[model samples]
Target: MTTITVSPGDLPLQCLYRWEKERGPQVYLTQPTGGGAVLDITWAQAAQQVRCMAGWLQSQGWPQGSRVAIIGKNSAHWILADLAIVMAGYVSVPIYPTFNAEALAYILAHSEAKALFVGKMDDTANIKNGVPSGLPLVALPLAPALAALQWADLVKNNAPLSGQPVADGDQTSTIIYTSGTTGKPKGVVHTFNTMAWGVSSATHRVRMDVNDRYISYLPLAHVAERMLVEQASLRYGGRIFFAESLDTFLMDLQRARPTIFFSVPRLWVKFQQGIHGKIPAPKLKRLLGLPLIGNLVRKKILKGLGLDQCRIAAGGAAPMPADVLQWYRNLGLDLIEVYGMTENSGVSHSTLPGSRQTGSVGLPYTGVESRVDVETGEIQMRCPALMKAYYREEAQTAEAFTTDGWLRTGDKGQIDAQGFLSITGRVKDIFKTSKGKYVAPAPIEDRLVLHPDIEACAVTGANLAQPLALVMLSPDAVARSQSSEGRQTLSTSLQLHLQAVNAMLEPHEKLDCLAAVTTAWTPENGFVTPTLKVKRNKVEEVYAPHFASWLAQGRPVVWADAS
Candidate 1:
């Protein structure tokens, strides 16, 4: 693989022009249409369409710097609309399609978005109702339910925008609302330079080129996917493929054969569960332990999963279980865990390929300045790609930064002598017990979820004398626990599992009991964020009251039917 050098120009739009001029007919986006068909758009075509849409947006006479919200799933038109917003001198606000009507309304009103772009959605009527009464709506090509100005019609009717306006480096390009796991979403403001510099600098660590293919399945509204997939494609001229739907995800993955792939730990765990379901764990482990057949088994599994062609597989958004990481490594895949936040342009630490260390997010990317504060152990960073501010919230923005200037990451982490960073937990998530010991629940939960049957777990004690674990079992695990005999078996196994986990922890940090719950924590339930990180506060709010009762029962493991 030859190294591809990219001159990321002062603006991302400039890079678009450069790619259009050099690789005019090269396919830039491969979008999936209905009935197993795909629509390929070349670099030149993409640029022209963007310009046409920009011209239409300019004609709308929206004020400069006005917020124009784009609500949709990942698609070709979504990226085009984001670019058109920047080209038209307005700020782009991308909303998660999974957001409820209430969240949609909150972001629309808070950002004061003048125009709305609608794309493929599950509940079009509900989303449409969330749009402000007077906001102009433009439907993307696939959003047929929305009776609004069609995207393709506008592009065909308008002429290409002449003389694309150059954006100032400090000009706000987009306002990305954080997944409000704790409360209402706060808008994160990023400038053109922040996007360009962050993506370019981070891509240097992982080599990319026109030949590289990527699957854009993760919500592009998240900063990590936006930077890694969208901006990386802009900078490196890579071909991007979009997943059509959940049912066709594997087929889409097989079709793309992406060279670089990224997914949150939750999805990664699901993939593991899917494989384990197809092949029973003990048999699969025995097969993999064989010398001759192991290679063939791993290859067959990788090919089946459509990851045979993947070179750099990354896991982020939450701490990946070490056992899961090792499972992929055993199959000859280097799955690196990356660490970052929305305030930092999602460019922080990443494990290098072939040099991966499980449980660590690796060293900070080149040109990124990172340090752990002595007192709080909170990670602070100063970089060119850091967000400008939280939009319209000066008090919150001021609190985000230290008195000096470093962006406070709010994550408690430690850097080893060799510069590798390991996230311990969130500073705010640390809770004190009634016994006067402060406990960080993440490390404990991480250990608990290492059990194969456990899907997700949260540790909470708060005002209680000792901490207890609230666990959500995997689907298969839930099925196993349905019968009286199966439940007893699972209870015995998990009790021993908890004993083993407790053996490794200090007395103060040990979990007093484990409560196996029936309810699965999911994004739809407001228990997990879009990025798949468990909302610790939300989990504690629902389960803390039961902790004392469970502990008072004097049982090592208590089963709660929380469904």
Candidate 2:
């Protein structure tokens, strides 16, 4: 076994201290607002704001360990509040900005956050739902219309913490809420050291230099972003630029020109769909197949997306269909697949450079021990970066760790003879059909998702005779269905493409019944995780009530259920 050593205080905060000492007030964050660099904050300047906020918190007179939540989109203020919460010696709970009112209420109440910092209140209704009783919230980027107190005002007016600064190495850093298969949310508590360890471990695997620029678009509340941005950025002294909205996301990306870009399968699917729609796949493939045209076409496409200089492009939070992986690789964009959970501080393994393999999540990072439980086939990990416990849930905490402390990931995976790990299906996700045959949905869905039409899918039939799939088609696929239906008249010529996909799939994994919900699966809707993986059970419930007749039909391959 190989080993990697990390010295104490060598985390993100250490990076900031280095930057502050070496280069005074260099730009660390920026967002293009109006004219010149709308918002830019240097390391020292940002630290002053954080210290001021920390002072304000000390003035609040709450318990030192009370959970403080951040309720808004990404901003310089958002980052500062997160670091300030830690500086004030409080646990920071970063909530998804898109969570609906009911979910907001549930999380706020469950986490017992004493105060909140809300940024970008465009979704005020959702914000209101999570507002705790008697708890004060300071809103950043406060507009005239929003009723929340201004976070900037609070920080500006309050004095900085007078005494010794908080540099606790083992304090509880955060409690990130992840939606459960049971339709509930569990808060995963991680210590500063655990998160710091994750960043350091990933640095060795990815070799993140000080020059790396990360676009922080994924919800910071997620383990993926928290470790990468909060922990890794802090340790490596990289700049973080948050996307303003969909309108400016591309512009922001072009402006930041990030060295490392990480997005989920859904976003990647959208990008692929955009390119496919612009130039039909068959035509583009034929053009690229030509010797002279191939390199030029790839270069043009990469430049158009501003990924010509991207060092690493990664996709995770869900299994990436191999064909999509191939499509990008063909265009000279090296997108690698990664696999991990919140329990492992977001990244347990990643496909290392020069060792890329499609259909496999790749080798475990240094110091992370992974073994498949022979009985259940579930992957278990023992690492220095493992979470302290599920917040306030003692029984759950005890259940998570083995007697010797290996964390049960609950994800079923297999390691090839050479140690490349491929996740198959979740132990909790695999269920028996009414026929009593155990069905692993992820593998089946992975096969079906390779079809160009499918955007996202979930397979469910726990007690039914056979498995069924609920698919959300890509925008292009939906548009093509309109024309395809006009041309054909039978199940052979369909009004919807789900039937076509069902035909394309190998029998059991095919769609048993299909319906056009036409709604996107997103973090706010509770159907997807913050990192954009479908919460399979939530997806099943949302569509299951509409699939009664299909289930009654014993999972026969068909179009919509016959009323």
Candidate 3:
């Protein structure tokens, strides 16, 4: 087995060159098409494509520090464009394909992206309409809507770059825009040195090597997916597979047979639900009790999940349910929970391979110094991989760091004597869905209250499949709902209002149900704080016991039913 060693000064393109020379024929990526075709590209071929793309980009004579944006799903060409931008001395700005027109426009305009690389998109028309005029558009092979120079055309017409251009380790590598709790998304700037340091630490912690294979399904724009799947692969020389689409995820996973698997808790729950759908919980438990049968069943279950060969399975982005972790462990797979943030280049803490602690997100990684703030209990850390600053936001950057210069993680956590960190809650009011998307309740609550019928609402969904909005009807609205006919009309209006509200929310932030409490909440009921603010936790405590029932009702609006 060969071990690849990379230094901070060594650009990723240089690593590709080494791989091309040492093992040119080795398959680097497997790109699947919706038509059931699989395209296997070798290291030599990928290097040539990247070189050609980079040369073409350089020929454009874009100024240094220019921002080039890539919006696409996880694919080989997406990565090729990223490498090309970096090697051509431009910074890459990756936008999530699912981003609405508003988000897409903001990122491009804010980043000052000179060019955009478009790939497979769910809403091509929305993208076409959102893209500002005069921004150069280069369509990838899979982009069916854009009438621009295709990726293949560029590769065929341009010559491969002959030599690696000198790129300083301290130069900005990319600007990753993370959704914020207010206003617009914030751009997190990372230098080549930051990325290199982070990836090196992650690789060391995960024990990655050349023989590993990864399935790239999550958005490449996200720092977690980039680190675990893309950056780790580049640093350690691992083969990567791209899923064709969500519908074929299982098939793609089976084909990849990845040695390294990383997914968010939502998908983990879906996997559990999928297995339970096939094999009921009680039946599974009974079957596992039998010695010979249990072993066979476990192997079968893992094989079906495409994790039979997985060496390192990890869940991150949000807290994974302990039961779900135990379920995987029962099948002999230790699903490690990783904790990190984009500001830290996704380097912070991760549970070691065999050190299984159900709720804790393991010890800090090498060179990461962590402490619980005495006043706020927020987890703070300092590391070499921490981003230099938020792009164009000096005030926010200053606020992110403590007086002592440590990065505040904004997560309330407790460190055990054993050094394992358990996240107690978020310091901010933002709550993350199972899919790991953050929902800022304030914004959503503001929208909900605008409806004349709704007086106040609290948005909550901690560890839930989706967020729920607890609605309290206004007095006039409640007075009209006494009659059966009036109640029906109100329900209809509320349903319509719910739909309208959902239309404005991101997929993960969409409410699962609207529970309208008959009793009014006020300061007298202790549901309001002394400052006249809603005690969100108190409201949740009173109604949380009914949440499962309300969720199970499956109605968009479930009225108090006959018990």
Candidate 4:
């Protein structure tokens, strides 16, 4: 594991050139084509394609700093297009592939993008209505058929850009839009220097090298993926693999055998549930306790999940349930919990390898400075990688930072005596009951989701007598509920689960009842963000009207669709 040393001031393009010169023949990206076929791209090959595309972009005569937008799923071409955009002296704006037509249109209009690069996407029905009339569009290799210039044509028509061009450190590199859990998405601006600083500083803690392998499946639009996968790879010169689709994700993971893996809480939970489906929880637990057979069972499970080679498995985007974290640990994985936000380049804190503490997000990164506000208890941190500003939002930009300097994280947290940070809840998310008791739903929701049948849960009862939980059943649970016998079993299990969760909570925070809903919550339905964090406001808006009726029912567990 030889580590690459990069200067803190080196920009992304600088690192790209270094890798192209040193690791020219080494594979840089492994992209999955349909039907299990993969295309291996070398560093020199990727550099040539990037240079040709950059030349084509430069020939278009857009201003040096004009905005260039990319909309698509994670693919090798997506990364190539981003590098080309920066190489052409333009700013890149990456939009989530799952964004609705309305969101797509708003971002394009807001950013005033000069051209758009379209790549592989699961759904393109919205493109017809989402893209403004007559916007210049270029299609990547796997992009759906569209009336646009093709990437192959551009590469054939243009010569590679002549010399290694360097971008100014202070120049704006990208405008990343937040997932917008509450309001309209705001563009977070980061300079080349800031982005470089984040990647360089993070590598000191995470320890990546040319021998490492990574799979890029998370939304590249998110800051975390951008920094960890794209930029980090450039700095460390590691090979990256792309997941073809949801159906082939496991195959992709097995193919890559990634040495470093990162996932959100929801996906991690699904992985756990998948294992339990094959081996029931109680039986699996008993099997794992045997001295001789336990190791074999652990290896089999890890190999089946394609995580046997993983040295660093990380969870982020939301607080992972303590029980879920322990489940992976029991299988010989030290799952690290990372904490950060879009405004901070997602390089704030991460638990060290082999030193994980169960209920904490771990220590801050080398250059990060953190403190909990004395008055509001909000976590505040300032670092070199902090965003420059919110694009075109002067008032909001001013409000994001304190009068002195630190960026307000808006999350309430506390630093323990050992300097580990534990997030309590969001300041804006705390609500009060009618009796004047305030309850934080995050902790309670964490406990409720420990039930195998529960997929997602939200606790809310503002101004009501007692707080209540709205739960969405797992796919397995929903399938079983089709039978009367299975439904009865689920009802009994949920009632007992409710009682156990309530016993662990304070009187003011105990849930009145658990209401299992029939509707599925997804990004398409505006219930969850692309990162899969529940939109608390949206959940309350859709279910608040039924609170009184649900309370009136005397049953401990009620079905929202039941008559």
List the candidate 3 regions with Cα displacement exceeding 4 Å.
1-10, 430-563
lDDT per residue for candidate 1 within 105-174, as digits (tens), equals 9999999998999987877765766877877899997775876888988999999987656678778999
What TM-scores do the predictions have? 0.94, 0.91, 0.78, 0.97
| Cα lDDT, model 1, residue 3 | 31
Each candidate: how many clashes? 0, 3, 0, 0
What is the per-residue lDDT of model 4 for residues 17-50, given as tens digits with 9 covering 90 to 100? 9989999999999999898899999999999999
lDDT digits (tens) for residues 67-96 of candidate 2: 898877677777888888878888888887
CA shift of 116, model 2, Å: 0.2
Worst 10 residues of 3 by lDDT: 523-532
* Model 4 misplaced stretches (Cα beyond 4 Å): 1-9
Error of 3 at 83 (Å): 0.4
Error of 2 at 150 (Å): 1.7
lDDT of 3: 0.82
The 10 consecutive residues of candidate 2 with the worst lDDT sum are: 486-495
Q: Which residue pairs clash in candidate 1?
A: none
Error of 3 at 295 (Å): 1.1
lDDT at 148 for candidate 4? 91
